[model samples]
Target: MLKGLARIWFCWSFPTMLKGLARIWFSRLTPNSIDTFKELSAQFASYFIRGYKYKKSTTCLISIKQWEDEVLRSYIAHFNKEALLIDEADNKILVAAFTNGLWKDKFLFSLYKNDPKTMADVLYRATKYMNADDALLAHEEKPKKRER
Candidate 1:
């Protein structure tokens, strides 16, 4: 059963799932979209906090895949159920951010989550402090320099 689910999750349909998630992220947070910033921020904060609280403890930095996988697995173990408190949009955003291979030195909880405002502040700080490679377009690969 797990193998079947894995096969489906890793199949060609995965891209579609990512795309759908992206749409949700954009629609919820983008200016002039349906949801207000406060509403979207609240929704995002809800998930971000849950994910952070449930984040695995580690002395060393781990890959984004490891971070997310650990969080999901931990959720399943603790709750004895599937699906985390976070929505797919939050999951995709975190996965997309981490999968880009930037910010491997930092954990997801590095961002503040005391409240929605602090959380937004952390996100703002991230945009200003993190390198473009770390914060920008997850799907677009940075061009590699040619060796001399």
Candidate 2:
């Protein structure tokens, strides 16, 4: 557990923990610009909080399409990642968006044959399809035995 770690130590080490734009932002700051942890935290919040304030709507999910060559698993993963950023997205809307984005395939055919009412149902069904897709890929990758 952490012990004897003082505020000064935290202030000094904070910049090292940052990456990408944050690291660049910290590097650009004038030397000795931050005097206290509270001031540093406040400045960090003020600089980055604007981006966090704008939450994407469910409508944004409608624009996400499963690319021609993208696997079902990857598309579902990407869709789920973006879906998490939305605040209280409706289950029905999520299902619709997810279904709309999918291209014509076994999964899409399954979805059409047995339509899902909730996002959870859609994900559950997708899991089965993803496993099947993986199994098919594994089988295809195996070398065939030559006939004697």
Candidate 3:
């Protein structure tokens, strides 16, 4: 009975851990197709293992541009997501790719004026900008006082 309950717990929690395309793929599987945790693991591994073998190159980061009118926080979030998938990504290369993808904005100017040598430096600077952006957004979102 404990083993059954454990299986039920794992089956319930497993899908919640998936993200993006993997989540979608898991959701679309036919009902009863995965009766056991082993079956589910095998199916998931077989489907995704092929893609795992081909890790995305750093060059992919070069293509992730900040869209027009997109907020700094959004762009940074998107960039970091892709950056995480890369294996042994070079700091210099990541810094260059991140800089190249920026739209003409305050952050771009900042990057140009004080170039970051490493990905850590870039992320640190971006964190400050992201905070500033969030603060500005919060300020804008506050209800203004009504004129008497």
- Expressed as tens digits, the lDDT of each residue in 20-137 for candidate 2 is 5578667878998877667877987887876643368889999999999998889989999889879889988999999999998878889989989998899898898888778998
- As for candidate 1, its clashing pairs are none
Regions of model 1 farther than 4 Å from truth: 1-117, 132-148
| Sequence-dependent TM-score of model 3 | 0.62
Q: How high is the lDDT of residue 118 in model 3?
A: 90
Candidate 1 residue-wise lDDT, 34-112, digit = tens: 3333665576677556644333322111233333345423422332221232333243344333334333444334442
Full-model lDDT, candidate 1: 0.41
User: How high is each candidate's TM-score?
Assistant: 0.18, 0.65, 0.62
> Highest TM-score among the candidates is held by which one?
2
Q: What does the lDDT read for residue 130 in candidate 1?
A: 48
Query: Can you tell me which runs of candidate 3 are displaced by over 4 Å?
Result: 1-54, 133-148
- Which residue pairs come into collision in candidate 2? none
Q: Which lDDT tens digits does candidate 3 get at residues 76-128?
A: 89999998888899999999988899988888899889978998888889899
Candidate with better lDDT, 1 vs 2 = 2
Q: Which ten residues in a row have the lowest lDDT in candidate 3?
A: 47-56
